[model samples]
Structure formats: structure tokens, C-alpha cells
Target: MRLILVNDVSTVRGGATKVALQCLEASKDAGLTCAILVGDDGEGLKPQFAGIRTVALGERPLRDGPTFTDVFAKNYNRRAFEAMEGLLQESEEETVVHVHGWSQILSPSIFYALAKHEVKVIVTAHDFFLNCPNGGLINFHSGDVCHIKPLSAACLATNCDKRNYFHKLWRFRRTLTQWGVGEEFWSRVGIVLVHEEMEAYLRYGPLRHFTTLRTPTAPLTPGPVEVWRNRRIVFLGRMCWEKGVRTLADALNKTGRTATLIGRGPLLVEMQRALPHCFVPGWLSDEEVARLAGEARVFIMPSRMPEPYGLVAAEALMSGIPVIVSSSALIATEVANNGAGLVFDSGDAASLADQLAATDDDDLMRRLSEAAFSLGQRIAPSRAEWARRMVDIYMGRSSFSAL
Candidate 1:
């Protein structure tokens, strides 16, 4: 069988593209015929993995704005459609199309081509862009989580597009078009959810009819499950309001706790000034970040946004580090259910401080460290293992759902 990976970018920057790259590498190692189809719109050095098939159809229009045409046939790039059409013609019968994300880079046009070819497809929910009009399920004016039913009149009317009503109208139009395409595309494909909570959300929203399967991921590499010391906490990922990193730093400062911020973002200098005790070393290599995760006493992910897949938390767990994540986050659910770490109320600074103080007990840290290590064994999948399981799903060997 053939495995075709589809994502927005040719380079790995964020969660969706990184996972797509991982699948590409693993599928080739497992002796599966695989190719990656990307729109090289995002700025980065293109990846050139040896002995792997990598195809870039074209780039998105520089600073392209949407029009009524985008709501119609213009959403499909002619080059990408041709590329996918050729790929489908060659291996249409046995090809499994695994689509990661499609927004600014790749649009919904390719889905139409896949539908025409009747190729089996699997869509991984990296974000809610497919259904939610606002990109994330967040209210723009209020900066709060939005639970409105997707595509409803109320949802369409809500100006939650992060800019203004004009932007909201644009997203609303795009989402309307997406709903049309997704109805046809998802009906002919199965869904892959990184977390069960995402399954719950999707089942009750758009694409609810499509079959879904759970695919939990582990860290890329296993770190030594070292003993826990009373070292400072570590915060990885973007340092922004949406990530709640600033809130976390505020809590840490208020509670007199110190931690390390490993990422760079708009609030970096402000955060450095506010949390005088916190250390900001900017972006580090993944190896260095993993090493720090292993050495740190605890990891904190106070995301105010609803993170469907918590890769940062999984990586820390692999290193035997417990997480103190937002209660509303999917990772927090994993920690609370499995004893991997503690949960603070989402976006609540005082509650975060309370949880941060609770981790001061050495005995509790040791217990959490051991439990996180055990959880890592369950969540972390080796590359080969992930490839084999994905092949099973591709070949109709397994199926799962909350239903």
C-alpha cells in the first residue's frame, strides 16, 4: 500500500507539520511507499531527507487576500490539484492520503481532487480550522474560549477572527466553503484524533459522521528517567498570551518560584522584566530542550487556549518530568486521569501559584516523576511502532471511536 502525507509546509515548524514529517520518515523506514505533498509558502529551509519522495506543488500567493472567488473554485490551486490528480491516477486504488493541516498554505481545492479519485483519506485534527471559523475556538474581542456550535448562525455572526468584523466575515466565508468541501471529503475518509477529548468535540460538531480513531503519541527520544531534584520548573513552546506563558510567569513571580522559559515570542522582553527570577535563554535545540526537560523538576503548560495535542507535555513525560497544565487542556486531562502531574484552573494565576507551591514537597515530586515515566512508556511510541500502527489503520486492521 502507498502512504501519501499531506501538510501545509515543506518544513517542520509547528505541531502539524512536525507530525507529518515524522510519519514521512517512519513510513519510509518501514518500507512503505510514501511521498510528501506540501505548499512551500512558509519561509524556511526545505527538508531534503535522503531516499524519500518530497513534492512541493507551489507556494501560496504572497500576502494574498480572500475574495468571493475564494469561497468558490479559486480556493483550489491549479498546480496542487494537478499534482494530486497525477498522484491519484498512479496509485488511486491502494493509496492512503494522510492530511495534517490546510489553511494559509494549502487550501481546500485538493480535497475536491481526492474526492474525485475516491482515494482513502485520513485527516488528523491538529487544530479546529476545519470546522471553527475563528482558526481556534476562541473569541477575539473577549479573548475567551468559545463553545458555540460551529457554522451556526450565532457562530457566523460572532466576530471572533482575532482582528475585527471584516476578518471575521472573511473567516466565516472561508469556513462556509470549508464546510461544503469537508462534507464531501470527510464523508469518504476516516479521522485521526490525537486525544480522546478531541474525538468528543468533533463527534458533536462538524464531520461527526466520519469514523475516528485514537492515535496517542510519545516523545521522539527517550531520556534517562533521572531522579527528581528540587530544580526549577521549565516552560517550553511559544511565550504568548494565547499560550498563557505570561500568566504562568506572573504566577511564578507572585508565588516566589523560579522557572526557565525556553522559547522566544512577542512577550519575551516584557516577561523578562516582569518575572525577574525567571530565566529566558531564547530558543534552544530540541536535544537541549529535551535535556532540560529531563533535568527540570516540573514542566508547566498554562495554555489559555484549547490545545488538541500537547506534544510539549508528552516530551517532558518521556523524560520523567511531571506537568502542571491548565485544567481545560487535553494534556491536563491526561495528567489528572493518569497521575502524570497536577492541574491548575485554566488561565487562573492564583490557582497556578497554589499548584506551583504544592510541588515543593519532595516526596510528591518523586512520586509524580515515577508516574510520569510509566505514563511515558504508554504514550511514547517508537518510530517503527508508530509506522506499523498507522499501516494497520491504513489497511483497515484497526478502528476506534468514542461512539
Candidate 2:
């Protein structure tokens, strides 16, 4: 069996990329031919997949465009779709095309090509772009989840996140184009993989055509307790509006607990202003972030948007730190179910403060910490296990039995 893993980037650093790489590894272990196609060449791209055969689509077009829309569309047109088509045709039959991310680098054109070639396709919903225009299903300016269907004009007109009518209209136009093209080509997709149950919420809406596969994630386990300390909280991932940095700041202010905000995003200045007591460490190497996670008392994922999965939260749990997250976050649900973390009200700083206050009990913290370690072992998919699963899928096996 042969499998082709398609993504906008080849780096295995992020959650989606990790999943893709795991699949590639799984494919190879299962005695299947595996190849990767990336949309661009970057420092992280090639090195991360050193031993694997990879094809980089070079730099995407319109990268220098001033507006987000212009740059996004240009890259989609120039790289994603074209590369997918070229790679698909060059590969042999019975190939499983596993797609991870596509919005920024690849346009809707790749779906059409897949449809034309009669290839078997499986798309993993790492985020919400398949059903929402903004991809996160988040209103950018407001940091709120978009409950409305992306196919609706109301969703387009509301300019949900940008809060600008004109910008909303512009977004709507682009989304409409993408949606129409996708519907025409992707309606026949064989499967859609989601990490949690919350993804089912989207099935009844606009993306009802595809079959849903709910895959479980493994949790993180901390190395040692020597670095652990009390009253030190950590925030990981992008510091953007959807991540609820403002809300996290408010919670910190209420609790008077200082936090280390690791990761970079568009809302750095705003987060700094709102939480003067908090430290912004910027983007750190995975090793650095893991080290910091070990030192922290607790990790918080205050995202207002629906997190498809909370890789950072898992890391925190693995590091023996408790995690506090919003109920809307899928990762939070997993954490709560595993008894490894606490869940707060979505977008409510007060609720987060309450959860934090409750964590002062050392016994409770210890119990949660232990649970986190156990859950981490269960949730964080090993490189070998992921590889085996991909091979099963490529071989037309009904389940990832080896996983």
C-alpha cells in the first residue's frame, strides 16, 4: 500500500503536523510506501522530516500582500492546489491521500483535482476551517465562536470577528468562493477525522457530507517533580484573540497569580497591557517549552474558540502540572474526562479564577497531577503507534488495530 500525506507545512512541531508525521511513521511500519508533500520550503520543513522522502512546493505566492485575505488567497492558488495535483498524478493508484491543513497554502482547487483523479481521500479536521470561514470558527475581533453556519449569508454579513461590515463582506465573498468550490469537489470525501466528540456538533451543520472518525489523543507525562513549584502558572500556544489572552489576564488579576505566557501571536501588546504581572516568553523551542512546563504549577488554556485538541494542555499534564481550560475547548473535555484537569466557563474570567482558587488544596493538586501523568501515557500517541495506524488506513484496514 502507498500513502501520501498532504499538509501546508512539513514540520512535525505543531499538533496537526505531529499527527501527520505519526501517520507517515505508522504507514512505513505497516509495510506501506509513505511520502510527504509540503506547500513551502522553510527552515523547519525539511529538517523535521530528515529521513522521510519529501517534496517541497517552494515558496507560496502573494506572501508579501499587506492584507491577510490577499496573501492567503494567493498562497492557496500558487502552491497548495497545484502541488497536490502534481503529486497526485505522479503517484500510483490505490493511494490514500491524507490531508491535514490546506487553507493558507492550498486553495479549494486540490479537492477538485482529487475528485478528478478518483483518489481515496481522508481529511483530518485539525481545526474548523472545513466548516467555518475564519477556520477557527472564531470571530476574530470578538474572540467568540461562530455558531452560525458558514454557508449562510448572515455569517458572512456579520463580519463576526473583524466587526467590520465591509471586511465581513469581503470575507464572505472569499468564503463563498471557497465553499462553492469545495462543495463541488469535496462532497465525495470518504472520511473526516476529528480528535474529540465536539466535532460531531459540526456534522449536523454545513459539513454533513463526509463520514466522521473520532480518534483519541494521548496525554503528556512530566519528566520529574523537581522543577515543579507552586503559584506559577503557564500559558502556551499563540497569543491571539481566540486564545483568550485578555480573559487569562483578567483571571490573573483576580487571582493575583503571575503567569508565564509562552508562544507568540498577534495579541502580544494587548496581553502585556492587560496582565502586567504575566511574562511573555515568546516562541520557545519544544525542549524549552517542555522545561518551562515542568517548572509551572498549572497550565491554562483560556481559548474562547473551540480548540479541536489542546496539545499544549496535554504537554502541561505530562509535565505534572494541572491544566485549567474553558468548557468549550475539546481538550478540556478530554482532560475533564480523564480527571487530569479542570474546566471553567468559556470566556469567563471569574470562573477561571474560581478554578484556580480551588487548586490551592495540595491534596487535590497532587491527585490531579497523578491523573495527568497517567492520562498522558494514554493520550500522547507514540511515533511508532501513529505510524502503524497510517499504514492500516493505507492498506484499507477498517481500524487502526495496531494503535
Candidate 3:
């Protein structure tokens, strides 16, 4: 089978890109012809997929309009859909299009083309962009989950996160238009893959017509490194409001436990001011982050949102480190089920502090650490297995399965 993966960026900047690259590697292992189509090119990402064929859509100008209330919202690069249209025309009959992220890159035009060609298309819900305009279903200003349905007047009336009520209204209008166009084209999607069961619930509850698949992830290894001193607790992901960085910092301050923050985001300044016990190393190389994980005592994921798969949590578990996650995080379910970690009340600093204190018990930590390592083996599907499953679905050998 010939497979083509589409995403917004070529770099492994986020979980979606990481999973997409992993899938590409898995497909190659399965002896399928694979290629990647991306909207942006960056030096940090170029070497990650050295031998892979990648096509970058030419840069285009930003849309001319009134800027959103939040300046960050204006940092969007409009994508040229025509490039993707041309690419699909040259694809073979056996081609399977796997779309990861597309809100900022491939527009609705690509879906339209795929529908017209009757191409087998699979879209992974890496985030909530399809259903929510903000992509995170988070109010930018207040750092809260959005409960309103997509394209609803409530979503339009209240600026969920972008801080500008007018922009929220504009986004709602755009979402409505895109949904109409998407439904017309994507109603025939071969499958919709999600990383977690919680996402499946949300998708089925909102968009029930599509088939869903749940495939959790494991850690990436660069061999093993010598363990270091210091009872380090690491937080490794985007440093954003939705991630509950402030909450994590608050917990550390309240508990008097030192931590290392290992990612960059919009709230670094605030985090630094709030938590003196925390060390912000900014963004580090994957190698550095993995090395730190091996040395750390525990990985803390304080996300207030429903994290789909929690790749960081899996990685920490695979490295034999216990994880402490917010109860609301979807990965917390996996951690609790697998005995890999402990869960605290979501967004509660006191609860997180209490959980931290409990980790000091060596016996409990040892038990959880062993469970974490074992669970890693079960969750991390081999690349070959992932590829086989993809092929089976593409070849119509497996019946439609819902997550």
C-alpha cells in the first residue's frame, strides 16, 4: 500500500508531529511506500526525518483582517490548499491519506479533493481543532475547559481563551463554515483514530458518524544513561496555561519540593515568578530530556485538560519513573489502571502537594516504579505491529472498530 501523511509542520514540535513521524517509520517498516506533506519547514525538524520524502507547501501571506484581541492569535500562517490538491491528483489508487494536523496547513480543499477521488482517508484527532476553533477547547484567558458545543452561540458569545470576545465570535463563524464544508467531504472518512478513550467519548458524543481507533504509545529509547543525584521531578511538555504549569509550580511552592521544568511556552515568566523552587531549563533536546527522565524520581503531569495519550507520561513510565498526574488527565486513567503512577485532584495544588509527599515512601515508590516499567511494555506497541494494523485497515481486512 502507498501511504501519505499530512500535518501542519514537519518538526516534532508537539505530540501530533511525533506520532505522525512514528507512524511514517512504522509504515516504512511494513514495506509500504510512504511520504509526508507539510506546511512549514524548520531546521530543528529537517534532520529528524533525514531520508524521508517531504513536500513543503510554499509560504503564503497572512489573511488581511481585523486582528484577534490576543496578539498571539494573529500568529497564523495561511496555507495554500492548491498545492495539496495537485499532490493528490498524482497519487496512485492504493494511496491511503493519513491526516494528523491541518488547521493551519492543509485547508478544507484537501479533504474535498480526497472525497472527489474516493481516496481512503484516515484522520487522527491529535487535538480538538476539528470540533473546536481554539483546537484545545480551552479559554485562553481563564485557562478553563470549554463546555459549549462547537459552532454554538455560547462559544461565540464567550471568548473561551483567546480573550477577545469578537475573535471568539469570529472563530465560531469560521467553525460553522468549516464544519459544513467538512461534513460534505469527510462524511466518507475510512476511519478516525484517537489516542485515548476520553477523546473517543467526546468524538462519539459530538461526531458519532465516524469510526474511531485507540492506540496508546510507549517511550522512545536512546539506550540507557547513568542515573544522576537529586530527587528531581520533571515536567516535560509545552509550557502553557492548559498544561497546568501554574498549578504544578504552586504545588511545588506549597510542598517545598524542588522540580525541573523542561519545556518552553507562553507562561514561563509567570511560572518563574510563582515558583522559586522550580528550575526552568527552557526547551532541551530529546536526548537531554530522555536522559533527565532516566535520572528523575518522578514525572509530574499537572495538565487540567484531558490529555489524549500522555506520551510524556508513557516515556517516564518506560524509564522506570513513577508519574503523578491530574485526575482529570486521560493518561491518569492509564497510570492508575496500570499501577504506573498516582493521581491527584485536577487543578488542586494541595492535592498535588499531598501526592508529592507520599512519593517519599521508598516502598510505595519502588512498587509503582516496577508497575510503570511493566505497563510501558504493554502500551508501547511495536512499530511493526502498528504498521500491520494500519495495513489491515487500509486493505479492508479489519472491520470498522470504534474506540
Per lDDT, the best of the predicted structures is 1
lDDT of each: 0.73, 0.68, 0.68
Prediction 3 TM-score vs. true = 0.85
Where does candidate 3 have its weakest 10-residue lDDT segment?
61-70
Deviating ranges (above 4 Å) for candidate 1: 41-51, 58-78, 90-93, 182-184, 204-228, 400-403
TM, every model: 0.87, 0.84, 0.85
191 Cα displacement, candidate 2 (Å): 3.6
State the lDDT of candidate 2 residue by residue for 1-403, as single tens digits.
5688887766544577767666665666666676777766733445545666677766542222335555456424645566677778775756788888776565666665676677767778777667666667777766666777665767756667444667556545655655565554555554455564545645633344443343435333337342234666788888777788888888889888888998776778778777777788678886676666666777889989888777777666666677889987877767898788799998999999999888877788888888877777666556555544455555666542111
RMSD of each: 3.4, 3.9, 4.1
Q: Which candidate is the best by TM-score?
A: 1
In model 3, where do residues sit more than 4 Å from their true spots?
42-54, 60-79, 141-143, 182-184, 199-201, 204-230
Ranking by lDDT: 1, 3, 2
Clashes of 3: 3
Error of 1 at 167 (Å): 1.8
**lDDT of candidate 1 over 1-403, digit per residue (tens):** 7888887776655677777777776677767788767777433324446455666755653224545544443355666777777777775447889898777656776787787766778888787776787667777567678888887889877887755887678667766655666555665567777766676566544464344333445553476455366486889887777788867977987888878998877678888888777788888997887676666888888887788768888877877888899976877777888888999988789999999888888888888988988887777566567667777777778674423
Error of 3 at 118 (Å): 1.0
